[model samples]
Target: MKVMVQPVVRLLLSVPLCVLVACGSGQEPSPKQTLPLLPKDEVLLAADSSKRAMIVEQVLGFELAPVMESVAGKIAYDETVTARISAPVTGRIVSPLPALGSKVNGGDPLVELDSPELGKAKQGYANALADARLAQGAYERAKSLFEHGVLPHKELQEAENALTHARDDVSQGLMHLHNLGVEDEKIDNRYWVRSPIAGVITERHVNPGLEVRPDLAEPLFVVSDLSRLWVYMNVFEKDIGLIHVGTEVSVTVVAYPNEHFPAVVEYIDKLVDEQTRSIRVRCRILNAQGQLLPAMFASVDVRSGPENKAVVIPLTALFTEGEGDQVFVKLGDGHYKQREVKVRLRMKDRAVIAEGLEAGETIVTEGALLLRTEEANEQSEIDAP
Candidate 1:
């Protein structure tokens, strides 16, 4: 039981199909048909916004900041023991080191040595002194005779020369004994070695009866005056000019972060190290609690340069597109241009410009990322169509 369609209904379906076929074959559109399009300015704005602001990449040109006014440095011992002290002559140690870490006066006994060589030096000095006394008397008698014309001038001169030689021998012999640790009063085998300077003993080399020699396998003792110390720091080639003598600076030690010691620049190296490309700056620090130690890894900062306005820009403004750096600056009115700038260095959150933008110029810190992206996209579009 199927229903049959009328002939007029069949004719209406064929007419609608013929219209659809005519439209698909690119026939002109009807009078009311028109293409839709966005306005040119709106299109530009849309395209620019589509490039999108980079994830809130904020940028702003900061006011000219004053050059840094202050800095810091470190403290250390003014002198250092580069080479350890060794026994001058071979000897047998008699007494132990004189009270480790004791503040000793100059010429104080540091250690005592027992050696037959020391005794021999003392005997030689005594013999030389006796000879000098004999020579002096002979010279005096010869001078008197010469004045009276009984002895010749040459004979008196010989006597004087002999006395002089004897005296020199005695002095040399005494010094030799002294070097061997022989003190003036004690004439026994053991001799006392006097300290060279007033300081604390840092190291002890030998014990009693141990043979000491000039060999520097280990130091006998290290003595240093801890009251004053030096802090040495390396300044990079660019930062070296900031360091200068008499500049007061601060030092912070890794060991004591809570405390920052005040120090002054004592020395600035004239030469830069070839390997590290750094110059050494020496700072003098007063060790109040004797807390500062040598090679303790301290940080130093020195205040440098006169206060002046430095042209700066936001770090995000630098677009390293190719070989050069570039930024967009808003000229007077709505005009903006892609500008190339030379960055001096990174400053805090911004960058210093050695060239390019001037102080009064307004730069497009914000929306720069979007502008670059738009420019790149437009270039691609023009090349495509």
Candidate 2:
């Protein structure tokens, strides 16, 4: 009884499987799709054709603005507000070097140096003052003696000349001391290197005992007003015509990828580099938040002159036929015309039309190639007669 029951169950399962296979094999195949009909330069979609296969949109006017993109640039301090602090006299740096990133005023001391040059200048000035005082007394005595005929005119004249020379020496000595930044009150050789501008100290190269000189290759300190900065870009000659002194620009940096810094063209080189055919373009940007730093590499986009209005279309909507450009212009009721067009410019994803198109006209933006294929097939069939 058990063997008979197993055979019946197997038979029932096998019968259902055979029925399913038969049902699938007997079904009719889907009907072949029919393409749109073409008449000369026009295409007419079949009644059963799905309209969603292609995207259609009204043509609109777009302003064509000249732009220089992805230009390599660098951030720098504005020279007008930046000062490179260096020692005027040779000396060993004393204690308390100006801290990096410290805010300072114009006259704030940055470094103190003890130099023999300062001491010598001070001594020379003091000696010159003493000599001038003695010469004045002698000149007065000589004048009195000359008036009373006790001294000869030649002797008085000689004394006057000596006095004049002495006064001149005093003036020279005083000027020297002032040039060394040594005040009259300080008798020692303590020379303080002060900042010439009110800004934050962005650099430092001095230690407590490091020797410094006036001709050091690098300045001991760099103080700059971080509120403004300069950006330098190298622009090639082909695009230089579009840029001018007042052109607007936008800058981006790797460190701050999402932020856009606005800038204006401040300077442009008159001479182009013979080898590179490039010129230096300088721009100024306001950095009130101190987000940009000197030496940071940046990408700059130069937004040149005013833009011209023109009709533009998506690149997908444009089709090439032999040597000319063409697009499918919709003429209502699933009818489209393949019209020749002249492209003024080919951008990344759009084409600027110079002729054969107008604003407010409907055009095929996505399926231009479909119409092109249909027209070709129809032409072949008609020629086969």
Candidate 3:
């Protein structure tokens, strides 16, 4: 009886002793026992009261905004207002040519040329005028003689025919001079090369004493009205159906990144480029202040169709992760989840989300980075061995 009672007492004493040894041992706590468990997509910040106060929350909503398609483009001169000024008649440039960028009015003299052809024309005109006067006097005299029976009728008729021929020669010479831009009062060997339209001389191709002709391949000057410009864009074939002749467009240039110029779609190419599979689009822009320039790189946004309903949020609410964008949404008090969202349109200070978000949901606009940082720290602790 004594032996059985002693063995039971020893077993009871050994159980409490093993429990005390395990509790008193110096060992690190297991992460599963110490760290708070959270859903893979969710994070909790209730432990940090300061972090909760730093976060800003907002509800998503929709707005009416024009649907737009963005494409790369470049600035070009408006062809209607551009002109290549060339000499109308073949001659040497005698007058001082206007300096490049000189503003000129219609008929403004760009060059004065001394041409041998002009001189000969002037001489011929003078000779023809003299002959016409003499012939007219002779015809009048002959008519009077024929009527008074002083001259034969056949001789008077011959004089009248000669007068008609002389008059024709005179008129032909005068027409030639007029075609050469020679004024009747200023008939001379010198011909002034004048601008046909009012604009600034954008290019100069001739110098004083340089011979120029009407058929020269290169122009003597290029005049363009810089008050307006054209932006040329290439649109994908798929987007061509959405564009039209009178759609509104917005343009931006690298030189002026912060500014956007409003424009209108003026032309669309009927043919598609075979290599790029794209269509050419042109937009007319008003540059009353002449701030835009030709050949500058530009970005174009064509306003397509009508406004549509979309989920929109402030731009600040977005955060980038991996190759896509992300945002944080509140699940409950001090609980948030990171979500991947697709941004459709980015405006001045807001963004339109095409996916991964819904209206009336609360998202963290401010202190999003803080939440991300906290999540990273918690992950590190849980992952430590």
Candidate 4:
């Protein structure tokens, strides 16, 4: 009888356990569903208008900004003001060469050459002068005789023709000597290499007793006016159209990185370099202080177009997203929108906007990354279950 009672008790306990399980199952909660976050082009800031003002700064608009193109360049001599001093006649260098960096005046003798050819030319000139004098005397005597009816008119005319021919010979010989740098009053065998322009001797290749020739590949001296300089820039073919004569340019050199030299575009090559596919542009710069030197590496900024009103902003305000550049613009209150902008030019600390921005729109100068971080957090939260 006791065993039968134990079995009935166990059955009652099992039935109660099944009813408890059913009740617990009915009270279970369903999985929570979340809403999607804001789109990538937008973000909502947690800060209010007043707080945002403290965190970031904004400007209403910008004035006209110059559009510029930067290119690598090198400083060079202004060819218009530069001279390559070479031996005018084939000879040996007789005099001491002008020291490098020496200031010279126009027509100052820099190198004296003892040229046998020059000596011969002088001798020929002297002989021609003597012949001319003899011819003139004969012509004068013939004219006088003809006037007194002592000589025939035809004879006097022949004498005049001879005199003219002799004078022409004398002129030709004297011109030859003059071309050799021989003075009329001081005709000598030595040929003086004179500076064509007043400048400093930038280079010297000749020494005393060195043989130099008119056709020498290397110049004896290079004289340049250091008061002016030239910068040669390799402008891309696409930007060649913007570079024209008289365009304003600013140049910076490694020696004076903080200083910007003012210059003007003086020339542009008609042909493009086949290897670089770039056109050569030349800019003339004033070097009154003589600080700029040739062969110095330089950075050239060529002002392409006229100054126009553009949406300019600090470079710090820009952010890169994948292949595009973006900036956060304050919409109103605590809202911000990520805008894709066309960067026309990027300076050291400023950016010139070409599109996707207007004059009156306010931008986030600071706390932009905070807004972006908020956007990412929202996305992650929406993805979480």
Which candidate's lDDT is highest? 3
For residue 186, give model 2's deviation from the true position in Å: 2.1
**TM per prediction:** 0.55, 0.69, 0.71, 0.70
| lDDT per residue as tens, model 1, 6-55 | 88789988998999998889967679643233222111224344443432
User: lDDT for each of the candidates?
Assistant: 0.68, 0.84, 0.85, 0.83
lDDT of 4: 0.83
Off by over 4 Å in 3: 1-69, 149-160, 305-326, 329-352, 355-385
Candidate 1 has its poorest 10 consecutive residues by lDDT at: 38-47
Residues 229-255 of candidate 2 have per-residue lDDT tens digits of 999999999988888898888898998
Ranking of all predicted structures according to TM-score, beginning with the best and ending with the worst = 3, 4, 2, 1
Q: Is candidate 1 or candidate 3 better by TM-score?
A: 3
Instruction: Choose 2 or 3, whichever is better by TM-score.
Output: 3
TM-score of 2: 0.69
lDDT of 4 by residue, 1-385 (tens): 4366888899999998999998888956888874436676677655443445544757648655646556889999988889998877889988876679999999998878888878788888888889999999999999999999999999999999999999999999988877766776455677788999999999888778999888988899999999999999998988787668998888999899899998999889889999999999898999999999999999987654455567779888888888888888877767788888899889876788988888788888877777787778777776678
Error of 2 at 274 (Å): 1.9
Clash number for model 3?
Answer: 0
